[model samples]
Target: MSDVKRIATRESYGKALVELGKLHENLVVLDADLAGATKTAMFQKEFPERHIDCGIAEGNMIGVAAGLATTGKVPFASSFAMFAAGRAFEQVRNSVGYPKLNVKIGATHAGISVGEDGATHQCNEDIALMRTIPGMVVINPSDDVEAKAAVKAAYEHEGPVYLRFGRLAVPVINDNPEYKFELGKGIVLREGTDVTIIATGLEVSESLEAAKKLEADGISAKVINIHTIKPLDEKLVIESAKETGKVVTVEEHSVIGGLGSAVCDVLSENYPVKVLKIGVNDVFGESGPALELIKKYELDADSIYKKVKAFVS
Candidate 1:
C-alpha cells in the first residue's frame, strides 16, 4: 500500500502527461486550445514538437486524434468535460468507438467542481454522456495517484478511453502508486456490512470520509471506489449490495445515467437493495468554490453519511 496524499486528479494528469512524454516520443498530446486549463501545457512545454493545439475545435480535434490513433501513435486529447463529450460525441462514436481507437480523452474541469464558472462551463452530465458511448471506457479517478495510474493504463490499452478528473484538490485515499490498474476493476476502500457506498471521482474521497463517520456512528459502511464507470464491476456491486442489503451511490456527476444509474442497473438485474444516490440532482450548477458547489448539490461526505443512515435505518 502506498501512502495516500491529497491532490487533485487534474494535477496528476499534468504530471503524468509530462512523464509519459519523456518516456514515449510517439506519445502525442492534442489540446482543444485549453492546454493550461486541461493540464496538457506541461506536456507541451516538455515536448513542443509532439503537442498539438487544435484551437478550441473539439470535433475537429477528435477527428485528428482518431487519425493519429490509426497511425499507431498514442494520442491524449485534452479538453473540458462538456465540449469533449458533447461537441465530439458523433466523431468519437463513429471514429473512435466503432473502430476501438486507442485515443485517450483527458477531460478536465468536470462537474460543479468548475466552481464559479457557472452551468455552461460546469459539466455534471459528462459522465452519463460518455459512459453511454459504446467501446468507450469511462474512468473517473479519485485523486492524483489513481489518475496517474489510469493515464498509464489508458496509454497501453487499445480502445477509446474517457478519463475525467476534477479541477480542485481533494483528499487522496489510494496509497499504492505501484499498484497495477485494471480497466474495469473497482477498489474496496473500507470493509463493512451495514451499507455499501459506491463512488467515483472526487466522491470516492468523500465516500471514504462518509464511511469513517458512519463507522464512528456505529454504522459499518463498505466504501467502494468505482473508478471505472463503464464496463462496471457488476460482480463487486452485486456482492456488496447483497452483503449490505442497502447501498448508496455517489459521484460528482448527475444522478441520471452516471455512476448511480450504472450501479442501480447492475443491482436491479441482480440483487435489488434500497439505494440512496448522492449527486447533482439533474440540475446545472452556478459559480462558487468547488467544495461549496459540491455541498450545494449534496455531493459531500456528510450528505452521504446522512443518506446512508436513512437507508440503513
Candidate 2:
C-alpha cells in the first residue's frame, strides 16, 4: 500500500478544471483565496481570465457563482469544504440550489484528512449539509481518476452539483480501462456474500483492502464504491444488501447524516438489513498528521477489517 502511487483528489480537481476550461469557453472558476491549497491554482494558471478569486468571502463567492450560471457561464466555485459547504450554506441553498442553477462546487479539503487544520477546517458535516439542499447532486470521488471524471460529469449535468475532494493523497484504485464514471452510479469493486461494505471518497480503497482481509478470515465482504451520494444507486445497494444480509458503510465523514445514514435510509425502507457504520463517531477532528488521524479515527484498512470481522461473526 505504501508503494502504490497516491494523488490527492484536490490535485485531480485542478487538473480536470484545466482540461474542461480548454473545451468549454463558458467554463469559469471562482475561488475564495485558497487557490493554492485547494489546487484551483492550476486552473488559474491555465485560464487567467476565466479564474475569479473572491478574496476569502465564501458566501459571496457562492453568490457570484450563481450569478455566473444565470448568464450561461458554467461556473465552478472552489474552496475548502468547511467554507464551501458550511459557511456558504445559506447562499448555496438559496442562490444555487433553490433555483437549481447550473453551478459546480469544487469543495476540497473535506473530512478529517484536512489534518493540522483541525475541526474548524476539517468538514465532516459538508455531505450532510449539502444533502439537505433540494435538487443538489452530491458526489464524493474516491481517487484521482474518479475525481477528474466527476468534474467533467458535473459540468455536463444540468443542475447544482457538490463535489467533495480530500487533501490526503490516496491510492489510485480505479485506473483500469474498464472503469466508467456515471453521474448517479455505484461501482462494485469486489463481490462477496457475507457482508456488503459500501464506502465513499477516501474510504473506498480502504474498504477494498479490508475486504481482502475479511476474505482471508473466511468472511466474504462485498465492496462498493458510491461516488454519487444524493441520487444514490439504490438498486445496487438494495441488491447487495439482500445478497449479503449485512451491510457496513465506511466513510471519512461522520456516522451521522453521511454515507452511513444515506445507506440506512435506502435499506431501511427497502431491504431492512443490519448495518454497522465505520466513520468519525459523532466527534470533531483534532489537529494531527493526516495518516495518524485516519488511524486514530479507526478508518484505516486494518481497523475496518477488524470492525467488519466482528460485525460478521
Candidate 3:
C-alpha cells in the first residue's frame, strides 16, 4: 500500500478544475477564502479572472454560484465540507437545490480524514445533508482518478451537484484502462458470494483490502465501490444483495444517514437483508492524526476485516 501511487481527492479536484476551465469558457469557480486549503488555488492561479473569492462567507459563496449558474456559467462553489455543506445548508438547499440550478459544489476535506481539524471541521454528515435535497446529486469519489472523472461528470450533468472530496492521500485503485466511470453507477471491485461490502469515498480502498483478508479466512466477500450516494445504483446494490444474502456498508461517515443508511433504504424496500454498517459509530471525532482516527473509528482495513469476519461468522 505504501508503494502505491497516492493522491488526495482534493488535489484532483483542483487539477480537474484547471482542465475543465481550459475547455469551458463559461466555467467559473467560487471559493470561501480557503482556496489554498481546498486546492481550488490551482484553478485561481490559472484563471484568476474566472475564480471568485467569496471571503469566508460560504452561504454568500453559494448564492453567488447560484447566480452564476442562471447566467449560463457552470459555477463550482469550492470550500471545505464543513463550511460548504454544513454552514451553507440553507443557501445550498433553497438557492441551488430548490431551483435546481447548475451549481457544482466541490467540497473538500470531508470525513474523519480531516485529521487534526477535529470533529467540527471533519464533516461526516455532508452526504446525508446533500442527499435530502430534492434534486441534488451527491457524489463521493474514491480516489484521484475517480475524483477527476467525477468533477468532469458534475460539469456535464445539469442540476445541483454536491461532490465530496477528502484531504487524505489515498491509493489510486481505478487506474486501469478498463475502468470507466458513470454517474449513478457502482463498480464491482471484487466478486464473491458470502457477503457484499458496499463502500464509498476513501472507504472503498479499505473495503477492498478487508475483502482480501476475509478471503484468507475462507470468507467470500464481494466489494462494490459506490461513488454516487443519491440516485444510488439501486440495481447493482439489489443484485449484489440477492447474491450474497448478507451485506456490509463501509463509509468514512456517520452510520446514521450516510452511505450505510442509503444502502439500508434500498435493501429494506426491495430486498431485506442483515447489514452491518462500518463507519463513525455516532461519535464526534477528536483531534488526532487522520490515519489513527480512522483506525480508532474502525474504518481502517484491519478493523473492517475484523468486523466483517465477526459479522459473517
Please give the CA lDDT of all the candidate structures: 0.87, 0.95, 0.95
1-313: candidate 1 lDDT, tens digit per residue:
1354577788899899889788987799999989888888988898899999999799999999999999989999889898898788888888888888899999999889899888998988888888778888999998888899899988888788999978888886676655556889998878997888899988888888888888888999998988889889999999998898988899888899899999988888889878888888878789898888788788888888888887788
Which residue pairs come into collision in candidate 3? Answer: none
Over the stretch 1-313, how does candidate 3's per-residue lDDT look in tens digits? 8899999999999999999999999999999999999899999999999999999899999999999999999999999999999999999999999899999999999999999999899998888899999989999999999999999999999899999999999999999999999999999999999999999999999999999999999999999999999889999999999999999999999899999999999999999999999888888888899999999888999999999999999
Clashing pairs in 1: 2-175, 116-287, 116-288
Runs in model 2 lying further than 4 Å from the true structure: none
In angstroms, the error of model 3 at 226 is 0.1
**Which regions of candidate 1 are displaced past 4 Å?**
1-5, 177-180
Tens digits of per-residue lDDT for model 2, 132-195: 9999999999999999999999999999999999999999999999999998899999989999
TM-score of 2: 0.99
Winner by lDDT between candidate 3 and candidate 1: 3
Off by over 4 Å in 3: none
Which is the winner by lDDT between candidate 1 and candidate 2?
Answer: 2
